[model samples]
Target: MKPTIVFDLDGTLALGDGPISAYARAIATRIGDDSFGERATVALIAHAAGETSYRDGYHAVATLAAEDRVSAEIVSAAYDDSRALLGTAGATVSPPEGLSGFLHGIVEHASLVLATNAPDAGVTALLEEWAIIDLFDAMHFQVGKPAGLVPILTAALARGRVLSVGDIHEFDLAPAAELGADTALVGPAAARLEVPATMRGRTIADIYERISGWATSAPHTAS
Candidate 1:
């Protein structure tokens, strides 16, 4: 059996601001603040540039909403609303440019897995729309992360080596690392997430060659 390479959904694979914007709209509507979306977008940019302390856009917006005294009940409802729009036209989700090609190139050497805290919502449709659903050997949704990832890693480890990749260290990479799996931390959060990642980069594309090296355990093939 091939080694398993696990990836996170959302910012880690599906990239765009639609989902964030939707989240902002929900919070702003609840708080009656129309400018919340713009402010949240600005904060998201800052987070990506390593200028903010947030883990990512969702975290920034959630924290801001809380600061505004939005109740937990309202906050959760807003989040659920945004999550329901994931992978749809409202969410504006799309794969990183050329990601499909890179993943396909390495598919033969490794078994790819998609694991996320997200509900099944738009996941299947999004993968189908991207025309890359079959690339993954396994798909796990509603994974609680940081803790929920332990069993998945354990199973993968039992088979062979495992590598878990995600933008967030705490939710996506830490547990895997603790279980002795190699990890790749990607996306904006990676800049400030000083975790023990076997590979880290600001974007998936930035570490393509490195991932390929580990996947093939040989010289990386041409991208």
Candidate 2:
């Protein structure tokens, strides 16, 4: 059985600044305030980048904007708009350096799966933009992390050794760890969180290289 590796899409497979900024812009635009958008963008990006929890930053921005009633509908609408923008003219997603080569090298030896909280369209657009859409053996989109990770982990276990890699300790790695999967934490935000992980790297490229080396040394038989 080929070793199974589950990858988080945003901030893990690609830089998330662009899309996250777009979400802030959408929220600001919806509220008809450019200044608010700028501030929200910073706060939201900080949250997405793992500086704070999503609820914390989101509520803080709402409060700062004097919005006493920040409903789920508003947040969802802004997120939907952001996804639309990313799929169209705002598409600036870029794969981590050397990711293409690394994926190609490990594809034959591993089963790669993409699991993300982002909507399907956004995930598809990013993967297509990066030209790695076909590399994944499976994909789960709009997966609410932590709780949403259960199904993904359950499925990957049947394939072989399961490993999860992402930039968020709570959303990406913690749940996977609960399921008994190996985990690799990537990026500076993850370092700041200082969660226990099987491996840690400053960037996705570092994690990729580490996994590649491991796969080489202990190659799995692909089913």
Q: Compare the candidates by lDDT and give the number of the best one.
A: 1
- Tens digits of per-residue lDDT for model 1, 59-170: 8998988777889998888888998998777778878778989998999999999999888887898888887899998899989987888998999999988888898888
Displacement of residue 77 (Cα, Å) in model 1 is 1.3
Poorest 10 consecutive residues of model 2 by lDDT?
214-223
Tell me, by TM-score, which candidate is best: 1
Judged by whole-model lDDT over C-alpha atoms, candidate 2 comes out at: 0.73
Question: Lowest summed-lDDT stretch of 10 residues in model 1?
Answer: 214-223
Model 2: residues with Cα > 4 Å off, grouped in runs: 44-68, 217-223
**How accurate locally, in lDDT, is each candidate?**
0.84, 0.73
**C-alpha TM-score for every candidate:** 0.92, 0.84
